[model samples]
Target: MAFDEGDAPGRVVNGLSVDVEDWFQVGAFEGVIERDSWGGLDDRVERNVHAILNLFDEAQASATFFTLGWVAKRHAGLLREIAARGHEVASHGWDHERVFRMDRKSFAADIERTRKTIEDCCGERVIGYRAPSFSIDQRTPWAFMELAEQGYLYSSSVAPVAHDHYGWADAPRFAFNPLPWSDLVELPVTTAQFRGKRLAAGGGGFFRVLPYAFSRWAIRQVNRDEGRPAIFYFHPWEIDPGQPRVAGAPLRSRLRHYTNLEKMAGKLRQLVREFAWGRIDVIAHREALRLEAEKATLHRASA
Candidate 1:
C-alpha cells in the first residue's frame, strides 16, 4: 500500500504480510477454539490458504507468512506451496500465545519451537516474527531483544500504534531497530497519522472493518505524504468468508472476525493494484541494511 498515492516525495514501498494459520490459531479465538479440534480442520486450512496463495501467485507477488508451528507441523504441504511459489516463511509462535503474557523463558521457547517447525516444513530458516494479536509491544519490548538473541534477523511483531490488545504507542511506524540490545529489525504494521490519531492502514480486520475508500486513502496518505513504506497484513481465513462461523464468540468479536469475508479478496486485489508492493523480508532487509549503513556513517561522523 502507498503511504501517499499521489504526493510521494518518495515512492511508496509496499509490503504484503499474511499471518498463515487456521481460524482456530487467532489469539482472540484461542480461548473458544480448542487446540485439539485444529487437527481435524486441516482441509479447511489448506483450502483457505491455497486461495490466498493462488491470489498472490496471480499477482506475481510474494508475502511473508507468519505461520503457526502447529499449522506448519500438520500442513507441511501448504508451507511448501508458499515456498515453492516464492513466498518467505516466518514464525507466528507456537499455539498463538501473547508474548507479554508469557515469561521470558516460555516466550523464547515458543519462538524456537515455531521457528524450527517452519524451517523443517519449508527448508528455510524462519528469520522474522509477527506475534499473535500484535502482542509484542511496550509490555513485551523485551521480546525484540530476545528474538535477536535467538538469531532472528528481524521481527514484525510490534503494531507500533495503539490498539485494544497490543501496541507501543510511542514506537516508530517505519522500520527501525529496537535499541540497547537488539540488532533485529522491527517492522511495525502500517498505521497512518490521520487528524492526529494513528489509524490502521490496509492491514488485518481493520481493513475489512473500514470502508474500502478509507483504507485506500489511509495507505495513500502514508505512501505519498508520510514518505514511508506501508505494510498490509491479513489472515488466510479472511478471504474465505464462507467458512463455518464460530459459535459462542463475543458478539463484537464474532462480528469483527466474520464480517465482509466475501469481499476481502476483491478488496485485496484493489489494494494490490493501487500500490506497488513486495515481500516483507525484501522490504525489511533492504531497509535494515540501508539504515545500518546510515548509522555507521553517523557514528563515524560523531567519532
Candidate 2:
C-alpha cells in the first residue's frame, strides 16, 4: 500500500534507501572487531529492520534496502518480507568490506557473491550497489566499472560531502555519469551545493546529529534551486533507541552511533512529510537512460 509518485503530497523527491546490516556490522565500528568475531553476535538485524518496515508501512512509503549478502543468506525470509512488501532489495556487499580496502579481484568477487545471494533471495536481477560508508569514491573508481560489468544499472555509493570517514569532495550534487563511465548511474546522496561547499542534506549520522531544520532547508533548496530530485537514506537501528549498545568501542564512534537514537523516528517522519520521496529503482528507471544519454551528448559536444 505504498504511495505512488502522484499520491505523495509534496514535491516528488527521488528515493529512500536503508543499509540493512546489524548495528555492529556498520563500517564505523569495523575497526573494533576481529572479522570472525562479528558472527558471534546474535543477528538482531531483522528485529531492528522490521521496526523500520512497520514505520514505512504506516507512512505508505516504498523504499530500497541495500542488504548485506551475509544477512540475506541467513535471513532470506527477511529479504522476502522486504520484497513482499513491494520494496527494492539491493546489495550492500557480501561482508560489508569497503572497496578501497580490497584489491580489484577481491572487490569484484565480493560484488558477484552478494549479487547472486540477493538474486537467489528475491528471484529478480539485483541492479544496484551502495558501498559501505560510501567507500567507492575517487580512491576506488574501479568500483563503477566493475558494477557496470556486473550488470548493475545504478550505484548510490558516493557521499560527495566531505566526512571524516569518506567523501568525494569534487563530485556533483545531482545524479551524473562520471567521465568514461556512462553506463552506470551515479546517485550521490543528496547534498546542497552551498557557497562553494557541499553540505550533506539527507540521512547519515550528520542528519541525526545536526538540527532537523537544517536538513529541511537543504532539501528545499535542492528542489527549488536545482530542479533535481534529492536522495535520502537511514538505518533501522536509528529508530530503535533501546537496542543493546556495543561495548569497548571508541568514545567518538559510540557517540556517533548511539546519540539521538530516540529522535531519529520523529525526524524521519518530519522529513517524509516535508518532501516527496520514493523507491530508488523508480528514480533509476526514470533517470538512468536520460543521464547516460546526457553524458553522451556532453561528450559529443566537447569533441
Candidate 3:
C-alpha cells in the first residue's frame, strides 16, 4: 500500500520512548547468552538508564519507558526513578519474549505480569505496551484485544516497514485501531517514505547504522511534511558502548548491536534537541481527542 500522505501543517510533536532492558537481554544476544546466565552478566541497565534520564532532563524532554517484567522485578527502584523523573512507565512484556512465539494465554499472562510489575514499582498504571520485538503483526491479530482487555490503552509494537526479523510491511505507519470493536490504539514506530518505499526511520539499529543527517531529514519529513507525531524508541544499552560484548555471536547481530555505540549519545542529544518530544501516554490521549473530534464532525455532517 502507499504511504499516508501528510495533510496537516508542519508543527507536530513526536513521541520518545525507551525499551528498558539490559544489554544481555536483547534478542540479538539470545543465541549467545542464556536466560539462566543473565544474572551473572554485568548489568549496566541502571547506570545507562540514569544517564538517559540525565540526558532527557538536560534536553527538557519527556518520554515513556517500556520496561520488562524481569527488569522491573530486579530494578524496582529504577522503575520508580523513571516515573519520578517525569517519564511514563509502560510494559515491554516479561523478559524479551516475542508475541508470535506464544499462545493467547501466555501472551496475556506476559502482558499482565509486565504491567503489574511496572505499576507496582512505579505506583502508576501502565496503560501502554510495546511487544518485545514489534511482533504484533499478521500472526497475532488477537494481540490488540488482549492488550485492551488487560487495561492497556495503546501499544507501540508495530513498525510498518519490511524487515527480516520484525515489521508489518502492510500495517499503517501511523497510529490506528487494529480492532473495529475496541478503542485500543496501535501506535507504530516511525518509518519514512523513501522514494515510494517504506524504510525504518524510527530509532534503534536503523537510527544507528544510517547517517545522522538522513535520520534528521526523515524525522523532519514525518513532523513537518507528514504532519503526524513520529514515535522513536531506543534501548538503554544503546548508549552504553562499554558494556561487555557477546563473543561468538552472529557477525550481523554483533555489528547491529555494537555499531555506533560511541555515537548513539551524541546523535540522540542532537535529535532530542532538534524536535519536540513527549510521552506515549500524551500521544495516545491526543489521538483519543482527535478521534472524538472527528466523530463529532461526522455527526454534524450527517445531521
C-alpha lDDT values of all predictions: 0.80, 0.83, 0.88
**Best candidate (score: lDDT):** 3
What is candidate 2's lDDT per residue for 202-285, written digit by digit as tens?
A: 687878999998888888787787777788888877777877777788898999999898999888877776666688977876
Question: Per-candidate RMSD vs. true structure?
Answer: 3.6, 2.5, 4.7
lDDT of 3 by residue, 207-288 (tens): 9888999888888888778778989999999998899888899999999999999999999999988888888988888776
Whole-model lDDT, model 2? 0.83
Please write out the lDDT profile of model 1 over residues 1-303, one tens digit for every residue.
222233234556688888877776776677688877876763477888888888877766667888888788989988998889878889989888888899888998899888888898889878888888788876776787779888988788778776776778888888888865556888888888867888777488889878899888888887778777788899988888677777887877788888888899998888876777777887888778878898999999999
Model 1 ranges with Cα > 4 A deviation: 1-11, 41-43, 300-303
Q: How much is the lDDT of residue 1 in candidate 1? A: 21
Question: Best-fitting candidate, measured by TM-score?
Answer: 3
* Model 1: lDDT of residue 171: 87
What TM-score against the true fold does each predicted structure earn? Answer: 0.92, 0.92, 0.94
**How much does candidate 2 score in TM-score?**
0.92
Better of 1 and 2 by TM-score: 2
lDDT score, residue 171, model 3? 94
